[model samples]
Target: METTAPIVDRWGGGTCPFDAGWKKVMMWSFIITDGLLFAGFLGGYGYARTMATVWPDQSTVFTLPFIAAMTFVLISSSATMASAVWSAQHGQRAVAVRYVWLTLVGAVLFLGMQAYEWTHLIEAGATLSGNPWGDALFGAYFFVTTGFHGSHVLIGAIVLLVLGINLARGRSTTENVEMAGLYWHFVDLVWVFIFTCFYLL
Candidate 1:
């Protein structure tokens, strides 16, 4: 009998020459797939905006300052997530837990800002069907895309919270923290694109 190498070595113990842990490998795979999906969304948004005869000015319709603040908070959270992973890798469990908690706080603030924005927009006559703004599509796409992104943020926060709890209890490893960081970083990166595509240009 002869040993054979598996086509894909997701876990160790196979004949695969290169093997990152399963969690790390899966996280990268997920981020790549998710990135493509966001690309399609942003591409469609760009195409639609381009095809429109009279595209409304994004700045005019959305004048809130909090969204920009939210971006800053999200970017800051990415830093905290990186620190959490680094601390975990170094066996600084307490520091890792604190950093993860900070990241969750950032997420909560971002969600609060989004809720305010949504409420303000709805009060100002923006809806799924239309808006008082020059182009109705602006409101529709803005809500759909932003709401979608918000949902991802919400999910990421919840996952991070769980990872923090597990790490605190010694139920997980540094690899778990690193994997969670990958997902959080991916979500943050996607928001950057979403912000640019849907808000700035």
Candidate 2:
């Protein structure tokens, strides 16, 4: 086997070290790994759908205009998060705080919309065991993936609230705002794939 020496930059920085910060490198790694986990889930869903003799028609299952609104709301939140990070970077603390607040509003609306969807489905006989629509397994995949994503949204909201408080107290840093924005952006991007694959298809 061939071997190569580790590369180091000026000031003796190694390949894994970040010029930005260690937190950013670590955060990127965590987000990438989480992305793979979600991919595994969606891949399983795709395989199951393909191999099954019968799969639920997504249109009849999730046919609602409000779901599109939910997608739009989350996308808008991502933009707000970007603005928050930008403002924080520019030393505009109040603007950053206000944008983060807007992001939180968007997050709350996303969760509320999901709750509304769940209520409608559950009342129509959708359950973990089975749903009235089609394959029983469809409910499993749908709820598991969607619930996982929703949990991330809820956690993001809590993080935003904490960041908001810190910002108000003049304790939050630009790096802190950027880290939160990364996670929010990842959530929004992942939802696009989920929505396109599960709903639009």
Candidate 3:
């Protein structure tokens, strides 16, 4: 009797071909979904602003200098994240670690500025239930958009901390750094949209 060769199952195999690049693909998928959500929020905010009898003047409602500084901090963090990725790609572990630390510092400063802004706004009588600008939409847009961005910044900080620890322990390789870079870049890219839509225009 001749024995037949055993056939391997693609799905049950130790390494499935589809699973090899699934993580990166999933990240991109998630980013697209999140982009859509943000776009929806922004569209609603725009519509409400246009319809309001007394749309809030951003210049009067927001402290330009403070927000400008915060924006600078966030942009600086993105720069550091880019540096970190570059260093990792070139196999400079120490340089990558240092840049990551700088990035975390910038993240912390940005969060602090945001906290200060929120408190200042609340003290000035701007709340989800009330609007200082006479149009309720102002408060609603402020809370929803900034709150969402704040949450992203918080998550980015946590991820940065984890990546920093791993790098210090020699556990994170170049590929791991690159993976973290994807997340860092995404956060930065989202901020660009937020700044443009909410602050600039």
C-alpha root-mean-square deviation, each candidate: 3.9, 2.7, 5.9
Q: Please provide, for model 3 over 1-201, each residue's C-alpha lDDT reduced to its tens digit, 9 standing for 90 to 100.
A: 133222344444676546546667677788889888888988898898788788777788888888889888988889999999999889888999999999999989999999999999999999987766678777888788889988988998998999999998889877677777777778778878878777777
Each candidate structure's TM-score, on Cα atoms with residue i matched to residue i, is: 0.88, 0.92, 0.86
Those runs of model 1 whose alpha carbons end farther than 4 Å from true positions after fitting are 1-18
Checking candidate 2 for backbone clashes, the offending pairs are: none
Tell me the tens digit of each residue's lDDT in model 1 across 38-71: 7877777788788877777767677647678989
The global C-alpha lDDT for each of the candidates, from Candidate 1 onward, is 0.84, 0.89, 0.84
lDDT of 2 by residue, 64-148 (tens): 5878999999999999999999999999999999999999999999999999998888898988879887778888888899999
Q: List the residue pairs that clash in candidate 3.
A: none
Task: List candidate 3 segments past 4 Å from native.
Answer: 1-20
Error of model 2, residue 147, in angstroms = 0.1
Best TM-score goes to which candidate?
Answer: 2
| RMSD score of candidate 2 (Å) | 2.7
For candidate 3, report its TM-score: 0.86
